[model samples]
Target: MHDRFDFLKNISPHHGEVLRNVLSKETRETLAAKLDVMPNGQTWYADIYQKAIYGPMVFRDPELNIIKTIEKLLPNYRILSDLYLEKTPDDQGFPFHTDFDSIGFMEHPEDMLTVWIPLTPVEEAGSGQLSIVMEEGAVRLSLIREANQLHSLVRVVDSSVPAHPPFQITQQEYDYLERTKVTPSLDAGDALLFCNAFFHKSEDVHNGKRSAYIMRLVRKDAKFNKTRLLALKKLGQNLAVVDELLKQHYPDAL
Candidate 1:
């Protein structure tokens, strides 16, 4: 809808308790059991990320209280069909970056927001949690005016395995983010909804693990360059720019 960049909305004590069971004891036991059989450097939560990112949660109960609440808060927007899981095992959190977006917000940042709900909660003093900078309105408006394209990542390597992630920004920009960021600690039934323009990341976990369900909600009326996007095979035009990021950061990836 071409709106101003709204900061994160702390939505908690939601109907998420109902959703938590989906990742049940059976799920944990099954995943833990697989560790002996898993390949090197793999954790169960990461394994879940790969398997669930685009595959699990094919359907949602439209009548669920949480779903209805999200729908109400996000008028004129529709949630994407695929809901996925995020697992932050001990000692791992993500580098700061905005969306690892598929639709690629392009010229409209306000038209999209990420809905992050923790199935299992974390204390405010917890070791591993999400930290973000809720930029002031003028800076936010200006930043997203470029469609939130100029964003940064921390904890990324110049060259190594799993190197050269996409949607990165300049080091100076990254420095500003590091100085200004604050952690958002969620309760068991809590959900954190943040705008597409904001840059966020996970801090390394030092204790118990974290698991959450994440999904994207986009305005139904947002513009799309369907023909050209289709030509790029869904990676879209932004990916070309990412190639430079790869060369600059993880030179070995190319």
Candidate 2:
């Protein structure tokens, strides 16, 4: 399944660290070591990028743990999708964009977040590590909401197809993102959680491959849940994507 928790046992024991009991350090080390030795398989999630595999729900405890973590941070939240994995080659990197806009249609971008956990130790920026814009890019996000055109940001990356040319913001918006972009050094087991609407990109890998898992968290009782649901249906999201999303989120309903 390539999900983060799938290879928890592979992580090193002494390196063990848990963030709010949601992520384990040993699991991170194990996953990294595993990626280092395992032969690369067929590309997964080609539609989103070259290497990715959007598999079935692999871990339920992680989702519950995430729920507990979010509740500690802020209450009344639920997950929007299952644990998803992505593998990027040395050459593939993404352009500046927000997961909120790309996946959730920016319906309530501020209320959502994307948790990125790299299985392998990512080198400095431009070495297949994440580059995040440091400024308060949420100002632009506010404008999208005020204009009631939030949907414009959705579908930027089709979950069903490889995202060719990667999605980038408009030239005007690029100026802000470029000014604040910072690629921080991240070790295995370190989890990067950011606003879904935060401007971020990836550096091309010069070292080896990069493996990571991402999970989306949304408010269960968010004000715009209905609106988001309508947009997802209208977009004709792939059945597998939609089904897994619902399964992790509304397990009893399924």
Candidate 3:
């Protein structure tokens, strides 16, 4: 993994207080209630499924103050997006993958970063633990066809007309994942930041509910094509308003 973890740690300050306030008992109860009604918001892939709730952008929410704090810590960068809450159970985990495929326009994938903050304490034995592999190792593995390429390769495979590579996880693949995966512990407010290119996954929730929020950030000079963005906006699915919002803030983010 190139020891890039230090860079991520350097950019983000200790925001345990802010995280605690945002995930306070009342907040968790309210969000949990929302989850009860919006189970469909959960995202499922292979071995893992998670309830994802978005927004309350850094511009409006107090918890988002972390953005500014991070900016100060890494003054050369700017946050590209808001946060996403992921709730998982002992039964929910994902195949190893990168987050780049889910977001659009990856012309320069390495420029992006994701900060995963656990809302509860996590341990190796815990159901929803984060797993990450070395970036260098993942890059080498990508060159070997038989290696498990859950994120990028999976997306390409899924996009094929007949979807050539089926989505099933092989036992060998699971064993490889188990061998490489590392469960990093985090208190309710601590966050782990890593490059988007990193191969990572989560363990199934076995005991307590695993709730986390992921925030995507990018450098200020990152290129975001406004025209293409508007074109996608015209398609007008769930992200139509997001296009309008981006245009308002970045005028050039189209």
Candidate 4:
């Protein structure tokens, strides 16, 4: 019954304003301007979800500063990935999913955290906002026991490829999620934090653009399971890179 979603209103309201202003001022030359290339196929903004480039104004010092700031906000966690720039129109959104298909062992899915920072407005039940099911942190611990029983099977299952067979919720599962779901109203600068295991998806953007920057971070106290990493490597995904990236971004975590 405990809700895992934590919404922080205006975590960086001024920073958000500064980002918009800076991007607007340098629109002509900055990659941020490439948003106009909507019909094109090459620019990052053309994609519904683009990974922020490191050299652009929105990404350069600004992103680094945000990373550092987030590090402060989450004192004991390690940054797991770079900023994912999500720019979706009123009609597009993602399906409900977790950070990954499986954690592969007795790891709690809540061990990881994903923070979403909106640059555009997001209203409850409005298009382009996020909808999340309120799941308690304990459910993941319970699921880990189920995962334990399936551990050996994962070692040899050819289909255990990291993303090959997507793990989507069944109708019954979704019904429960829908019953527990809540969509928080968020304006630019607000941050929504949630556990990796929570069932969530973006709402259909109905009015304007829903732009946000999302990234993942892991608890510093968590350790990577070697067996799981090996299982993923068999599937052609080098999960060791996740650890390496974490170390590179937050040396203190190591």
Ranking by TM-score: 3, 2, 4, 1
Inter-residue clash pairs, candidate 3: 1-134, 48-93, 89-205, 90-205, 90-206, 127-204, 127-205, 127-206, 225-254, 226-254
Query: Per-candidate TM vs. native?
Result: 0.56, 0.61, 0.63, 0.60
Better of 2 and 4 by TM-score: 2
lDDT of each: 0.47, 0.50, 0.51, 0.49
lDDT-best of 2 and 3 = 3
Give RMSD (Å) of candidate 4 vs. truth: 8.2
Q: How would you encode candidate 2's per-residue C-alpha lDDT over 1-254 as one tens digit per residue?
A: 01122222222111112233244676555444443444433333455554554323232346324456546654555655543344355345567755543355334456665566676677475446776643435335433532333444233223453333433457877776667566656666566665555556776765556767666666676444334444454655433555555555555534
Give the distance in Å from residue 114's predicted Cα in candidate 3 to where it truly belongs.
Answer: 0.3
Poorest 10 consecutive residues by lDDT, candidate 1: 11-20
Model 2 earns a TM-score of 0.61
Report the lDDT of model 4 for residue 203: 77
Clashes of 2: 13
Ranked candidates (lDDT, high to low): 3, 2, 4, 1
Candidate 2 yields a Cα-based lDDT of: 0.50
